[model samples]
Target chain A: MKLVCSKANLLNGVQIVSKAVPSKTTMSILECILVDTTNGEIKLTANDMELGIETTIEGQIVEKGIIALDAKIFLEIVRKLPDSDITIETDASFKTVITCEKAKFTIIGKSGEDFSYLPAVERDDSIVISQFTLKELVRQTIFSISDNDNNKLMTGELFDINGDEFKIVSLDGHRISIRKIQMKNSYAPKKVVVPGKTLNEVSKILPGDADSDVTISFTEKHIVFEFDKTVVVSRLIEGEYFKIDQMLSSDYETKVKVNKKEFLSCIDRATLLVKEGDKKPIIVNITDNGMELKINSALGSMNEEIDIQKQGKDLMIGFNPKFLIDALRVIDDEEVDLYMVNPKAPCFIKNVEESYIYLILPVNFTTVA
Target chain B: MKLVCSKANLLNGVQIVSKAVPSKTTMSILECILVDTTNGEIKLTANDMELGIETTIEGQIVEKGIIALDAKIFLEIVRKLPDSDITIETDASFKTVITCEKAKFTIIGKSGEDFSYLPAVERDDSIVISQFTLKELVRQTIFSISDNDNNKLMTGELFDINGDEFKIVSLDGHRISIRKIQMKNSYAPKKVVVPGKTLNEVSKILPGDADSDVTISFTEKHIVFEFDKTVVVSRLIEGEYFKIDQMLSSDYETKVKVNKKEFLSCIDRATLLVKEGDKKPIIVNITDNGMELKINSALGSMNEEIDIQKQGKDLMIGFNPKFLIDALRVIDDEEVDLYMVNPKAPCFIKNVEESYIYLILPVNFTTVA
Candidate 1:
C-alpha cells in the first residue's frame, strides 16, 4: 500500500484507533493496526476482541493494498514527525516504509488477514441522537459504575429507552446515580448495558463543538456507535442489572438546601481524619443552629459546623465520606437539597429543581465511640 | 500551647517544616512537628534523624507552652481552613485543639520533650551567599547524583567553596555535571558533600523571588543553612568523590553545533522504537549531509536524519536516549556544541559560551548485517 497524508490528519486518525489496541495480548496480531489504502482515503482499524475502533482520513493513494503495523510505535512516529506530508509504501515482502522530511522508518508488517474483522451493523436498525446529549448522559452516569470484575453486570451502565426520553442508571450497591435525557424523537424502545470502559473511550473521541448527529445500534450481544469518520463497537455484559429504582427511597421527613461548593469542601475536609483501613464514616448531625460534620478514626478527629437556613428536629446519620463527595461533585447546581428519611436509612441528594437523584446508603457507626 | 495566627502564614510555615518529617520512622515522635508558643511567636520543628528544619511565625500568644502533633494531619487542616485567624490550643492531657472560624479539630499530641533537638551552628564560621545563587547551583548538578545507596559519595553533590566563588559537581559514573557561581565576599575555604535528598527539600522551601542572603556553615560531619525565618541542617555524606574531570577528553576530532530543542525532540522520537526489556540504545550516525539517528528493537525500528552544517568523516555511536535527553535539558542555552573524540569514547557536550560541561559515555553496539 502507498499513500500520502498530512501529519496532523494522520496523527489524529492513529490516536483514535490506538486506544482500542491491547497493550498486552496473547495473540500477536491483536497488537497491530490494520491500514488499508484505497481510492482517495486511508482506513485504520484496531481491535482487542472485546472492543474495536475504525477511522478513515483523506489521503492521496498511489496503490491499493493492506498491511498491519505496531499501533503504539506507528502513532508515536507520526505525532513527532515535522508538520509536512508523510509518504508510506509497502514493499513486495510486506515491509512498510514510512518517510517524512528526512526521517525514514521501516516497520515489519504482518498479514492483514490475521486481524479479526469488525462486525457491521445494519443501517435500518440504527437510531439517531445528538452528540451533545449523548456525551452529557455518559459523563453523568459512567462514574457510578462498579469497577469490580467479578460482578460483570454492575460494571456497565444500564440504558432504558422508551419514547422520546431515556433513563441511564449506574450503581455499586452502596451508591446509585440516575439521570434522564430527552431525545429528539421516539424510536423503537430497547434496553442494553454498555460497559463503562467503552463509554469512556467514546466520550474522549467525540468532538466537542460539532452539531452533527451520531448513530447508535445494538444487537443481542454487541453495540456500535458511529460518528463523522470513526466507528466504535463494544461487547455488552450478559446479566440482569440491579433494580435501582426500587432501592431509591420514596419519602423523607427533613429536607435541607445547602450550597454545593460549600458542602463539597466541608465533606472533603472531614475525610482527612478518616483512616484508610478503618470504615471512613463521616457523621452528619443537623440541629436547630446548623449542621455539624464530624469524622473520628484512629488517626484523629475533625468536625465542622456550617450555618444552615433550617429548624428541623435534631438527627444524625453516618456515611462513607468519599461516596458523598463523589455524588456532590456531579451535581451541576449552586444549591442542592439533601432528603433524609431517618438516621440509618438511605438519603437522596439532588438539584433543588431537577429530576436527577443520587442515593447513598448510610454506614453503621454504632460500634465507634 | 495557645496562639492565633493567619491561616496563610500557618499554612506556609507548616508546609516548609513538614518536608523534614519522616513518613515512616521507628520513633513516633519523629513524625510529629513540635509547636512552641513563646514571646509572641510560634516555632515549628521537624526532623528525620539525619535532617532537621525549624521555622518561626508571629502570632497572638494567649498562653506559652509546647506540644507535638502529627505533621501530616496538621498540614492538611491548615491547607483546608478558610482564610482567617486560626486559634490553636493544647489541653492539659496533650490533646491539641485547632479552631478556624466554625471548624474544629482535636488532634492527639505527644509531649514536646520527646522530640529530638536540632544541632546548633556557630555564626562566626558561616559563609553568607545569595539564596538565588545557591538554588541555581543545586538545580544544575543535582540530576547527575547517583541514586544507589551503596555509593554514598556519588549520591551527594560535592560543594567546593574558595574565597568568593562556589563550585558544585555531581557524577554517577556514566555522566558528570558541574556548575560554578561567583559570590561577592570572601570567607574561609571549605569543602563538603550534601545529600541529594536534603538539597531537594531545601529547594522546595526556597522562595523563588527572595533576594535575601543565606548563611551556610560546614562542620566535620554536618552542613547547616540558615535563612530569614528558617534553618535547615543535614548530615554530610563521607568518602572521597571520584575525579570526574579526568573522564572528559581534551581533544575532539569532530564537532557539531545544533539547536538544543530540535536535537532533544529528534532523540525523543527516535527512542520510541526501544522496547522495555531490550537494551534501549539509539544510534547516532553523523555524515557530511547531516546526522542520522536510528533505533531497532523487538517492537519496531525508526530512522531520522537532521541536516547540519558539517563536513566530517562518518561516525556512528550508540547511547541511552534518556541520559542524553537529561543532559541536554539541563544546559541553559539555545544551541549546544557536541564534541566527539571517537565513535566509542565518551562525548563532551557544552554550551558555546558557558563554562558548564556535561560528559555522556557511549554504549557499545554490535552491528547486525
Candidate 2:
C-alpha cells in the first residue's frame, strides 16, 4: 500500500483511533493499528475488542494494500515528521516505509489479515443529533456513572428516547443525574445503556463546532457513531437499566432558589475540612432569607451562608459535598432550585423546565446540632 | 495564635513551607505546620526532619501565641477563603478559628511545642548569590543527578566553591554534567553535596526577580538557604562526590560544531524507532561537510544529516539519545562543540572556557555497520 498524506491529516487520524488501541492485551495484534487502502482510501483502525475506532485520511492513494503497524511507534513517528506531505508505502512482505522531508522510517508491519476489524452493523435504526448536543449530554451525565464494575449495569449510562424528547440518566447508588433535551427530528422510541468509557472517548474525538451532526445507529449488540469522516463502533452492555423515573419524586417540604455559583463555591469550601477516606458530609440548613453549608470533621469544621429565595418549611440536611458539586458544575443555568422533603429524604436540584434533575441522598449525620 | 492576614499572602506562605511537610511519617507532628505569632511576626514552619522550611507571613499579629495545624487542610482552607483579609485566632484549648468575609472555620490545632523547627544556623560561612544565578546553576546540572538511592552521593550534586568561582557537578554513573560560574564576591573555599530533592524545592520557592539575593550558609552537616523571607535547612549527604573532572579529558580525534536545535531534534526523532526495553544507540557520523545522526534497530533504521563545522579526522560514535538531549536541552549556546575520542570512549559536549561540560559514555552497539 502506498499513500501520500499531509503530516497534520495523518497525525490527526492516528490520534483519533489510537485511543481505542489496547495497551495490555494478551493478543499482541490488538496493539497495532491497521492501515487499509484496499477501498481506494487510507483508513486507520484500532480496536480493543469492546470498542473500536476507524478514521479515514484525506490523501492520495498510490496503490491498494493493507498492513498493521504498532500504534505507539506509528503515532510518535507521524507526530515528529515534518509539517509537509508524508509518503507511506508497504511492500509485499509487510515492511512499511514512511518518509517526510529528509526523514525516513522503516517499521516492520504485521499482516493485516490477522488484525480484527470493527463489526459492521446494518444502519436500519439510526438517530441524527448535533455533535454539540451529544458532547454536552455525555459531559453532563457521564460523571454520575458508577466506576465500580461489581454491578456492571451501573457502569453505563441509560439513553432513553421518547418521540422528540431524549433523556440521558446516570446513577451510582449515591447520586443520580438526568439531562433531557428535545431532538429536532422525531424517531422510534428506544433505550440503551452505553459504557461510560465509550462515551468519554467519543466526546474527546467530536468536533467543537455545533453545526456538524453525528449519526448514531443502534443494533442488538452494538452502537455505531459516525461523524467527521470517522466511524466508532462500541459494544453495548447487555442489561436492563434502572427505572430512574421511579426513583425521582417531586414531593418536597422545602424549596430554595439559590445562585448556582454561590452554592457550588460554598459546598466546595466546606469540602476542604474532609480528607480522603473520610465520609464527612456537608450539612445544609435552610432559613428564611439564606442557606448555610456546614461540614464538621475530626480535623476541622467550616460553615458558609449563601443568600437565597426560600419557600416551604425550614429544613436541615447533610450530603456528600462532591455529589452536590458534580451536579452543580454541569447545570448551565444561573439559578437552580433545590427541593428537599426532610433531612432523611434525598435533595433534588432541578430547573423549572424539568430538563435537568439531580438527586443526591443525604448522609445520616449523628452530630447535627 | 491570633493573626489577620491577606488570603493571598497566607496561601503563598503556606504553599512554600508545605513542601517540607512529611506526607508519610511516623511522627504525626511532622505533617503539621507550625503557626507562630511570636517576635512580632506570623511565621509558618514545616519540617520533615531531614529537610525544613520556615517562612514569615505578612500579617498583623493580634496576640503572641503558637499552634500547629495540619498543613494540607490549612493550605486548602486558606486557598478557598475569600480574597479579603483572613483572621485566624486560636483559643486556650487550641481550637483555631479562621474567619474571612462570612465564612468561618474551626480546626483542632496541636501544641506548637511538639513541632520540630528548623535548626538555627549561625551566619558564619555564608555566601550571598543572586537568586537567578543560583536557580540557573541548579537547573543546568540537577538533571544529571542519580535518582537511585543505592549510591547516596550520586543522588546529590557537589557544590564546590573556590576563590570567586562556584562549580556544581552531578554524575549518575552513566553521565556527568558540570556547570561553573564566577561569583561576584569571593569567599572561603567550601565543598558540600546538596541533595537533589532540596534543590528542587528551593527552586520552586525562589522569587523570579534577578536582583533578589539568596544567602546560602554551609555547616558541618547541613546547608541553609535563606531568601524571600523564607529559610530552607536541609541535611547534606555525607560522602565524597565522584571525581568527574578526571573522567573528562580534552584529548579527542574529532571535533564537530553543530546547531544545538537541529542535533537535538534529530536525536529526539530517532528515539521513536526504539521501544522501552531496547537501548538502541544513535550513531553520529562526522564528515567534512556535516554530521549524520543514525539509529538502527530490529524494527527499523533512521538517518538524518545535520550541517555542521567539522575539523580533525572523520569518525563515527554511538551514544544514548536521551543523554545527549538532556544536556543539549539545558545549554544556552546555539552552536555546541562536540568532541569525541573514538567509538568506545566518552563524547564531551563542552565550550572553550569549560564553563559547562557534559560527558556521556558511548554505548557499544554490536549491530554497528
Candidate 3:
C-alpha cells in the first residue's frame, strides 16, 4: 500500500481508530491497526473483538494494498512527524516505509488478512440523530452506570427509541439518570443496551457542533454508529434492562426550586469533612423560605444555607453528596426543582420541559442532631 | 485561634504550608497544620519531619489562640468557601469554628503544642540570590538526579559555592549535568548537597519573576530558605559528592554545531523504533555539511539527517537517545555545540559563556549497518 497524506489528516484518522485498539489482547493481531488503500480512499481500522473502529483519510494513492502495523508505534510516529506530507508505502512482504521531510521510518508490518474487520449490518433500520444531542445524552446519563462488573446489565445504558422520541437511561442501584430527546423524524420502536465503555468512546469522538448528524443502526448482537468519516461497531450487552419507570414517581410532599450552582456549591463544601473511608451523608432540610444542608462526622461538621422557593410540606432528607454533585454538574439550567416524597424515598431533580430527571436515593438517618 | 481573613488569602496560606504535610506519617500530629494567631499575625505551619514550611496570612485577630487542624480538610474547606472574609476561631479545648458568608464549619483540632516547629538556623552563613535564577538552576539539573536509592548522595545535587559563582551538579551514573551561575557578590566558599525532593518543592513555590530574592542559610544538618511570606526548612543529604570534573575532558576528534530544536526532534523520532526492553542506541554520524542519526532494532530502523557546521574529523558514535533528549530539552540556546572523542568515550554538550555542560557516555555499538 502506497499513499501520500498530510500529517494532520493522517494523525486524526489514526487517533480516531486507535480508540478501539486493545492495549493487551490474547491475539497479537488485535493490537495492530489495519491500513488499507482501496476503493480510492485510505482507511485505518482497529478491532478488539468487542469494539471496532474504522476511519478514512483523504490522500493520494499510488497503489492499492493492505497491511497491519502496531497501533502504538504507528501512532507515535505519525504524531511526532513534522507538519508536512507523509508518504507511507508497504510491499507484499509487509515491510512498511514511512517518510516525512528529513525523517524516515522502516517498520515490520503483519499481513492485514489476520486482522478482524468490522461486522457489517443492514442499514434499512438505521436512525439519523443530531450528533450534539446524542453526545449530550451519553454525557448526562453515562455517569450513573454501574462500574462494578458483577451486574453486567447495570454496566450498560438502555437506549429506548419509539416514534420520534429517544430516551436514554442508566442506573447503578444508588441513582438513576434519564435523558429524553425528540428526533426530527419518526422511526420504528427499538430498545438496545449499549456497554458504558462504547458510549464513552462514542461521546469522545462525536462532533461537537449540531450541524452534523450521526446514523445509528442496531442488530441483534451489534450496534453501529457512523459519523464524520468514521464508523464504530460495539457488541450489545445481552440482558434485559431494569424497568426504571416503576421506580420514578411524581408524587411528593415537598417541592423546592433552587439555583443549581448555589446548591452544588453548598453540598460540595459539606463533603469536606467526609473522609475517604467515612460513609458520611449530607442532610438537606427544605423550609418555605430556604434550605439547610448539613454534614456531621467524627472529624468535624459543616452547615450551609441557600434561599429557595418551596411548596408543599417541609421535609428533611440525607443523601450521598457525590450523587447530587454528579447530577448537578451535568445540568445546564439555572433553576432546578427537587421533588421529595419523604425522607425515606428518592429525591428527583426534574426539568419538565427538558424531559430530564435524576433520582438519588436518600440515606436513612435516625436524627439530624 | 480567632481571626478573620479573606478566603483567597486563607487558601493561599494553607496551600503553601500543605506541601510539607506528610500524606501518612508515624506521628499523627504531623498530618495537621498548625494555626496560630499570636503577635497579631495569622501563621500556618506544617512539618513532615524532613521538611517544614511556615507562611503568614493577612488577617484581623479577634483573640489570641492556637490550634492544629487536619491539613487536608482545612485546605479543602478554605478552597470551597465563597470569596469573602472568613472567620476562624478556636476554643480552649481546640474545637475550631470556620465561617465564611453563609457557610460554617466546626472541625476537630489538636493542641498546637503537638505540632513540630521549624528548626531555627543561624543567618551568619546566609546567601542571597534571585529566586528566578535558583528555580532555573534546579530545573536545568534536577532531571539528572539519580532516582535509585542505592547511592543516597547521587539522589541529591551538589551545590558548590566559590567566590561569586554558584554551581549545581547532578549525575545518575549514566550522565552528568552541570549548571553554573555568577552571584552578585563574593562570599566564603561553601558546599552542600540538597535533596532532589527539596529542590523540586522549592522550585514549585518560588516566584517566577525576578522581583523577589530568596535568602538561603545552611547549617550543619539543615538548610533554610526564606522568601516572600514563607519559610522552608529541609534536612540536607550528608555525603561526599563524586568528582564529576575529572570525568569531563576537552580533547575530542569531532565537534559539531547544530540547531538544538532540530537535533532534539531527530533523536525523538529515532526513539520510536526502540522497544521497552530493547537497549537500542541512536548512532550519530557527523560530517562537514550535515549529521545523520540512525537507530536499528528488531522491529525496524529509523534514520534522520539535520544540517550542521562541523570542524575536525568526521566521526560516528552511538548514545542513549533519552540522555541526549533530556539535556537538549533543558538547554535554552538556539545552536548547541557537541564535542566527541571517538565512538567510545563520553561526549560533551557545552556553552562556555553560559557555564553549562552535559557529559553523556557513549553506548558501544558493533556496526552501524
Give each model's whole-structure lDDT. 0.84, 0.90, 0.91
TM-score of each: 0.95, 0.94, 0.96
By the DockQ metric, which is better: model 1 or model 3?
3
What are the clashing pairs of model 3?
none
Q: How far off is residue A317 in model 2, in Å?
A: 1.6
* DockQ for candidate 1, C-alpha atoms: 0.69
Instruction: Point out the higher-scoring one by TM-score: 1 or 3.
Output: 3
Candidate 2 CAPRI category: medium
Alpha-carbon runs more than 4 Å astray in model 1:
A210-212, A311-313, A352-354, A367-369, B311-314, B352-354
| Residue-by-residue lDDT tens digits, candidate 2, A217-305 | 99998999999899999999998899877888989899999999888888888887787889998888899958988888877788888
For candidate 3 chain A, the 10 contiguous residues with the lowest summed lDDT are A360-369
**What would the per-residue lDDT of candidate 2 be over residues B255-327, giving only the tens digit for each residue?**
8998898788888899988887788888887889678888888768888778998879998888888899999
Tens digits of per-residue lDDT for model 1, B1-369:
789999998999999999999878888999999998754579999999899999998778899999998898889989988899999999888998899888888888999988897887555677877787778778878888999987899899998888987778898988888787678887778878899999989988988444788888878888888887999999999877777656766688778877788889888777777766666788888888788888887766778877665534568888989889988887778888888877778888876444688888899877656
Candidate 2 iRMSD, 1 decimal:
1.6
Clashes of 2: 0
For candidate 3, give the docking quality class from DockQ: medium
**Candidate 1 docking category?**
medium
Q: Going through the candidates in order, what fraction of the true interface contacts does each contain?
A: 0.73, 0.79, 0.95
